[model samples]
Every structure is written in C-alpha cells, then in structure tokens.
Target: MRALAYFKKGDVHFTDSLPEPKLTSPKGLLISPSFTGMCGSDLHEITDGPIFMPKDGETNILSNESLPLAMGHEMSGYVKAVGPEVTKFKVGDRVVVEATISCVDKHRWPNAKNANTPMCDACKDGCENCCDYAGFSGLGVVSGGFSETMETIEHHVVKLPDFVPMDIAALIEPLSVAWHGARVAKFTEGKTALVLGSGPIGLAMTLVLKARGAKKIVVSEPASIRRELADKFHVETFDPSKHGERAIAELRSIPEGGNGFDFAFDCSGVAPTFNTGIAAIHYRGVYCNVAIWGKGINFNPMDMTLQEKNLTGSIGYTVEDFKQVVDAFEKKKIDPKECEHLITGRIKIEDGWEKGFLELINHKDTNIKILLTPNNHNELD
Candidate 1:
C-alpha cells in the first residue's frame, strides 16, 4: 500500500513501498480511506516535528508505535474488513474513526455506567482523553488515514449517516476536536464567544458555537481571506494587526452593556493570540486553548487571578465528541454542503507532497483545509 509518512523530524513523503495495514487486535477494523484531510499538525510534523509523531527510535508506551509513521488523522472511509470480535459494525459500513487511543477497556461510557473490567485511573474518572499516556492513533500509533488502507480498533469508529457525503464525513474528525473544546469550555445556548484565528480549527469552532446557539460570535484573524471566510458564517471578524489591544474592546462591546464573551477559544497557537484570547473573556468566563503551541508564553497571573477566570486546554477528541458531531450533521445543525468552502483543494495521494502539504505551508493564510484522496480519484461535487 502507498502511504505518506514521516521518515524523520523534517522528512515526510509519499512512499509506495509501505505495507498494507493488518489488524493488531481482534477488536480492530480495516478501512479503505476515501478522503483524508491534511491537518495543520501533519504539516507541523513534516516541517518542524518529532513533536507528537514520535522520534525515530523512541516508542510511545501507550500505542507502542515508533517512527516512519504514516500521517493523517482526519478522514472517513468504508469498513472493508472487521475482526471477528467486532460486532458493532460489519463490512460495507460507512464510518469515521475517532483517532484517540484511550487507556480503558472498550464499551465504557455512552452505553454502560462503567466497565466490568478495570481501567486506568483517568479512565475510571471518565477522562480517557486525559489518561496519563494516551496517544493519538494516527500520530504516534500504527499506519494512519493517509495510507490507501488503515486499521483501527472498532471502539474508535463512528457510523456516518447515509446522507452525509464521504468528503464531508472526512471533516467529522476536526469537527469533533472543536466539539470537544466547546464541551470542555461549557459553551451553552445564549452565551457569546470570541474565537482567535480563522484557520480550520477556529472556523470549526465558530460553526460549533453557532450550532450550540451562541448569541454572538466574533473572530479575530489577521488574514483577509480567513476573515472573509468567517464572515460567511455570519460572525464578525477583526484584524488583530489593525485593532491591536483594542480587539477585545470590540468583542466586549458587541454584547449589550459590554459584558464580554462567555468563552474565548484560542486556536491560532500564536503568542499574541494567547494574550488577546485570555483578555477577551468575561469575568468568571472560560478560556479554552485549542492550539498546539511550540513553546510556552509568559502568562500574567493577574489575567486569571483578578477576574477569577477559568483557564483550560483541549487536545484530541473523545468518542463522545465524534458521536456528537455526527449527530449534529444528521440533525442539520452542521451542514456538510456549506462546509465545502473549507476544502480549498483536493489532490491524489501521489500529489500529496506538492498540492496538499506545500500548498498549506506556502498559502496557509488563503487555504482552510485540503483533502487528499488517498484511495479514490472521484472529485467531490
């Protein structure tokens, strides 16, 4: 099987010599990927990595995976084969796999109150996403969605609605990330929000905010194209370069009596955005950090101290998040048709390096998401 993989920290390319994936556990399922998204993290891994992709020699104790790792986590595909133990799904089922690797036994939450089998302490607390050593399936684990075929445990698979297009189903992964962030921050109906950045994650955050009935949504983005894209979602946009510290002033004044946003999500992963996002929240408000930053920023304790604000960070999504996103899509809360704008380009696997990865690296300000058709050549309508 052909796969785009990370050979070293800064080296990643498509290779035809990659072997076809096999199930490591009887609980696993094989998927022939239809559409796999080129995530910003994948670009980070290819450019300045070894961050989450695991270094050449080191193995992730949880996933037990090392390097030359296949890249890609956001995708949707059909179940071509299933292990004998996989009873939840069978062959020919359209599904989106949640990429998180939990420490608990399968069949825990969203069904039974608890697992009859023992689980990790974090998993026991219903925080498998925060388990001590949870690793993402695609990043540091086995072959990921970027390959022609990949295998994942059935516990991570979520069945997609028949009405959802395969290309749109590919977005379920990132949408779940945004959904999880919103869930973490306790975003509720009638609340207001300020999202920092208009990249894919930020845009997805805005859409999720809207779906949850956020009264006012404001996005601060420097890029004109991204700002315009946010505007299409009916949210106000601010150019941080122009507004500077006054960006928060605009966000606060949007709501009556200048109460400020109930939640602020920083998806830009930039030092400056971190300061602005924290300052934009209302007193006692929640600030969710959704970006994967390279280094720590100098955070003023008074920012959260005086205001009594709550600060939190979000990483990968849980199975519950994936289920919520699929439910939203099925209920028309998130329209797949409108999300087509997020796909700036779609390329074949062989062209992934130039069209998928480099296009994002060179023109990230203009592109939102790029889909790579690893196994199929059909153009998304």
Candidate 2:
C-alpha cells in the first residue's frame, strides 16, 4: 500500500511498500480514506518529536504497533469492508473516525501487554479521552488514514450524512476538539465567548461557538491572515497586538454589558493568552485552555480566586463530541459551506511530504487545513 508515513523521528515521507491495514476485530471496518487533514501536531512530529509517536524501534503501549505507521487522525473515508459482526455500517458508507485509542480498546488487541489490565478510572466513567493510556489511532496506536486504507473498530467510527462532503468531514476531528473544549467549559446557548488566537483550533472554536448559539463570538489573533480567516466565519475579530497592555480590557468591552465574556478559550498556549483569557472573562466565567503547551507558565492563583472564575483545560475528544459535530452539520448549525473556508488546499498523498507537511511548516500563516488524499474514491482529479 502507498502511504505518507513516519519512517522514524524527523523522517516522514511517501512510500509505496507500506503494508495495507487489516480489520483486527469482529466489529472493525476497513476504510478507504477520502480526505485526511494535515495537522500542526503532525508538523511537530517532524520538528520536535516522537512526542506522541513511538520511537524508531519501539511500539505503542496500547496498540503494540511500531513506527513507520501511516500518519493522520483527522480523516473522512468510505467503508470498504466490515467484519462479520459489524452491524451499524456496510460497504460504501461515508464516515469519519473519532480515532482516540485508550485502555477501553484492549479488546481490539487481545495479545497486547496491557490487554488484561483493568479499565482506567476515566474509561470506567465514560471519559475515554482522559483515559490513563490515552493515545490516538494515527499518532501511534495504529496505522491511520494517510494511506491506501486503514482499520478501526466500530466504537471509533461515525457515519456521515450524505449532505456533508468528505472534505468537510475531515474537519470534524478538529471541530470535535473545539466542541470538547466548549463542553468542558459548560458553554451554553446565548453565551458570549472570547477565543484567543484564530489559528486552526481557534477558528474551529469560533465555528463551534456559533453553532451552539453564542450571542457574540470574538476571535483575537495577532496574525492578519488568521484574523481574515476568522472573519469569514461571521465572528468579530480582534488584534491583541494593537492594544498591547490594554488587550484584555478591549476584549471585554465587545460583549454585552461591557463586563466580560461568559467564556474565554485560550487556543494559543502562551502566557499572554493564558493571562488575558482569565482577565477578559467576568466573575464566575470559565476560561478553558485548548492549546497544547510545550512548557509550564507561572500563574497567580489570586486572579481566579478573587473573581471565582473557573480554570480548566481540554485535551482529546470523545466519540460523543464527534456525533454532536456531525449532528450540528446535519441540522445546518455548522454550515458545510462555511466549514469549506478552513480547507486551504488539497493534494494527493504522493505529494503529502513536500506539499502537505513542509508547506504547512514553512508557511503556517497562509493555510488553515491542507488535506491529502490517496486518490481513492476519486477525491482528487
């Protein structure tokens, strides 16, 4: 099978001899990927990584899969085959995968080291995203969608509505990340939100806020290109660089009552965004960290203490988030055409390395989501 894979640390490339994936469980489905989005995390695996990816010679603790795996988790595909016991989907169904792998998935790898271990507390409580051994399918747990085909059990697969195009379906994974952040923040309809940084996840947070009926959605980004992208989603855009020390105060004035936002999400994992997010929200408001930080930042507990503001962070998402995002699209809450604005480019898997990965690394501001296809299902011309 041809694939774009992580051959080793700092060595991802396109290859033709990678083995085709197989359905390992009775409820599994074989998927021919239609579109797979390139993510910032994928770029990290090349520059600063093996972070979530297994080291060159080691295997993932959960899946027991080694390196050189196909490298994408944000994917939309068509069902190619199903195991005998798979009942929910059949051949030719359009779908997107939730892709989170955790201790609850021990059944899929009965021979693995921890297969017989007890379920983690998080999984037992139905929070697989927070499982003790949480990892993603493409990140390291299993071969993922940047290939000829990939396989995952029914638990991770979500059926796509006919109205949602495959390209738009690939955005569901990131949207689910934003959805989970909003869920963690306990966001509600008619609440105003302040989303810091209008990068991919930041823009995604904007769309989710709109779909959930936010009274006002303000995206604060320093980059002009990203602010332009956020504006296309029909949200208010702010440039924090212009205000310097007064950024937080200016952000608070945008929402009704001029007090502060009901919720603020820091999609940019920096100290400034972190502090600004907390200060920009009103008393008892929630501030959720949605970005992946590389290092720790100093914090003043008194900030949250005085205002009774809540501080929390969201990581990977559950299958339920994927379902709700798809439902949002089906009900026209997340307009598919609006979602199209996030897809900056599309390329064949053969060009995934130079055109997909490096393009994002070299010119991060110019693109949002760049999708790659194996050319399966005629997704590419």
Query: CA lDDT, every prediction?
Result: 0.82, 0.91
RMSD of 1: 4.2
Q: Count the backbone clashes (under 3 Å) in each candidate.
A: 0, 0
Task: In candidate 1, list every pair of residues with a backbone clash.
Answer: none
| Model 1 lDDT per residue over 111-136, tens place | 33222335679777867788765666
Ten-residue region with minimum lDDT total, candidate 1: 107-116
TM-score of every model versus the real structure:
0.92, 0.98
Best-fitting candidate, measured by lDDT? 2
Give the range where candidate 2 is weakest over 10 consecutive residues by summed lDDT. 372-381
**Residue 217's C-alpha lDDT in candidate 1?**
87
Name the runs in model 1 displaced over 4 angstroms. 105-119, 377-381
Angstrom error at residue 54, model 1: 3.5
